[model samples]
Target chain A: MSDDGPRGQVGKDSFEARLKSAREKQGLDPKASDPDKRLSAPSAMGVGMRVGVELVSAMVVAVAIGWALDRWLHTSPAFLVVFVLLGFGAGLANLWRVMGPGRMPGAK
Target chain B: MPQLDFGNPLLLAQVVWLGIIFLVLYLLLSRWALPQVGAVLAHRAETIAADLDVARRAKEEADAAVAELTRATREAHAGAQAEIAAAVAAAKAKTDAESADLNAKLDAQIAAAEERIAVARTSALGALEQVAVETAREVVGRLIGSSLDPALVPQAVAGVLAARAK
Candidate 1:
């Protein structure tokens, strides 16, 4: 019975010390990231889709406009060829803007 | 196949239909779906902000409570240690006082025993002196016809006792 006294004291002291140390280690930060700051899997997928949409829209619009202009001016395939390359470049530009380091259309 | 031909009026009709469809889709999106999506996004942002504020307040309160608990625990430990020390001191004081009392009692008993031994020795010597004197008187009376003087007998006994002591 008497021997248990020192052991109990040691256990209690260690427990208190650990509690103090653990509490001291804790920081006051809220630990919640802003919902918009970092993209989750779904949001990242959404962003990727937007980029794809941008690229495809640019290419389609360019091709459509070039085709219509060629027909209207009787210029057979000249405008089509030039606009196709321009649309390809624009698509690449849109892709870069979407996926680049700025992360949220800030590059544009 | 006619789509590839520049003179095909069917291609013009197809282009017109594409524009019409694109316009309708854009109108639907701008009118209905986009506003809904924007509203949902706004609502989500508001909910998240509110949740974060609540979480921050809870975290701060928890930290404060933990800090207070640690403070109280430390104070309790100090108070307990002081109490244990005081108890130990009191116990030691009691033990010392008891030991001192026992030692004084033993000293008194030892002195009383010595006084008793001194008194017994003095009494035994006085009884031996009386026996020696009576023995000398009896021997002198038996040898010399019962006419021995008491004063002379005491003087002779004193002389013999002094010689034996030397």
Candidate 2:
């Protein structure tokens, strides 16, 4: 029983050391602090869909405007050809903006 | 095919009807359905934000409590260490003082015993010298049939005893 005194003291010291380390781990755990990695995983498909949508929407608007203008002026497809090129350029621009280097991670 | 037949008068009517239907659907969605959906979304967002705020506050309070606990533990540990050190020093001082007191007492007793032995030996030697002088004087008087000088007996005994000592 007397020997238990030192043994208990050693056990308590070890437990305190472990508790301190565990607390430190909790405070500075990288996974706990950076949740964007988890959020970005499931949204990988969403990012692709968003890029496609952005490119298509710009081209659709451009082509629609070009077609309307041509119909109004009674042109022989010259405006449509020019507008198609412009639409292609706009679509590329939209795609660049969607996946651009300047874009922030995890941004909507 | 009917849509592509621009010559058909019915196609024009169909177009007008389609426009009217599209406009109505758009109006319905924009005026009622979209706002309701937006309101639901806003309410959900507000609830989530409130919950997050509560969680953040709770976490902050927990961190503060942990910090306070750590500070208290460290202070208590330092206090305990200081008290233990003081106790150890006191014990050591007390033991040293006790041992020193014991050693002084033992030394004094040894010196007193040695002085007593020296005194006893000196007295015994004086008695032996007196006995030797008396015996020598008596034996010489008996052998020569005459009394000897007491001063001469003592001086001779002293000279012999001094020679024996050397």
* Best model number under TM-score: 2
Q: On a 0 to 1 TM-score scale, where does candidate 1 land against the true structure?
A: 0.47
Q: What is the per-residue lDDT of model 1 for residues A7-103, given as tens digits with 9 covering 90 to 100? A: 9668657755654444333422334444676544346567667777888899998899899999999996999998999998999887777675565
Cα lDDT tens digits for candidate 2, B108-137: 989888888888888777888889888888
Q: Which residue pairs in candidate 1 collide?
A: none
Among all candidates shown, the one with the greatest lDDT: 2
Write one digit per residue (lDDT tens) for candidate 2, span A1-108.
347658866865775565445444444223335435533432667777777787778778888888898899989487888888898898888767756766534533
Cα deviation in Å at residue A17, candidate 2? 24
lDDT of 1 by residue, B1-166 (tens): 7657979888898899999999999999999999999999888767666665675567668668867987898899999999999999999999999999999999999999988888887677667667777887888778876867777766777687678769
Candidate 2 lDDT: 0.77
> TM-score for the second chain in candidate 1?
0.64
